[model samples]
Target: MTIESSRAEISRFRSAAVAGTLTFDPDAARRCADLYEEQAEHLAQLRQALENASETEGFGGFVSAQQLQAGFAHKARDAAELLDRYIEAAYRMKEAFLLSAGLYDEADAAAAAALRAVDTRVRG
Candidate 1:
């Protein structure tokens, strides 16, 4: 798939990740799958581009398949890390919502204390 299409898929995945459902939403799972697919597609395109470039006489010596693969692997690792961050943020949001719902007084107290600490630090 093309970069644009991969980007569109990732956008959809992000939307799904943020959209909640009643039960078994599968949004997170879908997001994970979409992310994986996007990474794979991106790697494939990179590999193809590298291969094409290597076939050019002048540019052939510029890069090797191993180097291209390593670059793709690095990008894929970055993508995975990004996905982990997104998932972590989503879970944190969910946890905060649940905490606020079930322990409003405690959450409020904590927030107030945190604000006071920040204010003191800023003033000091």
Candidate 2:
């Protein structure tokens, strides 16, 4: 998903969670985690490509070539850094989804146990 769509989804989740109305789906969470991981991998590949391009031989003695090379190097570095940040963010999102799934599972188990205890007392 695009960044805008992710942001919108996150906002919706935050609102629902705060209101105690969020519905947790383990399968959906797993799928989201997988997508984020895929995104991170793609970003990593792009970053590697950028790194390779940045290492290209510098220009010869010509003044314009030298200036252009310097500018390109600077911009390339900035782009690589931005891609690195995006990769990190994507991994973090993947982790968050996985954690949410585990937490939801735990919460459901706890609630079930609590209900079982109540039912035993009522039926005893």
Candidate 3:
């Protein structure tokens, strides 16, 4: 893909984030976790595809096999690195959802404790 295409995808994701379309609430944390796993697998596959592939068309005087392999490695590295950042963002969002859930639980417990105290005092 060209640089413009890459930028467009990045812009799309950023816009989604701005729209809260990527929201990961506590109830959907499980789904987000699954997505993170899938993304990890996808990235691994991309890396493996490049790492395991043999040189191509280096037979042409235009480029050597080593240069072609290096080019492939460079592209793979860039793709993998970009994907890793996105996956990490997803992971962070999942963690945020989990943390928010925990905070809610703590707040609920606190409210219950306060209610119990009020009840006890009022009944005495």
Highest lDDT: give the candidate number: 2
Task: Identify the runs in model 3 with alpha carbons over 4 angstroms from their true place.
Answer: 1-26, 54-63, 103-124
Better of 1 and 3 by lDDT: 3
Each prediction's TM-score versus the true structure:
0.34, 0.62, 0.44
RMSD of each: 14.4, 15.4, 17.7
lDDT of 1: 0.42
TM-score-based ranking, best first? 2, 3, 1
- How high is the lDDT of residue 98 in model 2? 49
* lDDT of model 3 at position 43: 53
Cα misplacement distance, residue 47 of candidate 1 (Å):
20
Put down candidate 3 lDDT per residue, 14-63, tens digits, no spaces: 45544556544556655654565566457546645754553344444555
| Model 2 pairs in collision | none
Residue range with the least summed lDDT across 10 consecutive positions in model 1: 91-100
Taken over the whole model, the C-alpha lDDT of each candidate is: 0.42, 0.62, 0.49
Q: Name the lDDT of candidate 3.
A: 0.49
Candidate 1 C-alpha RMSD relative to the actual structure? 14.4
Model 2 TM? 0.62
Query: For model 2, what is the alpha-carbon lDDT of residue 23?
Result: 43
Q: Which stretches of candidate 2 lie over 4 Å from their true place?
A: 1-23, 103-124
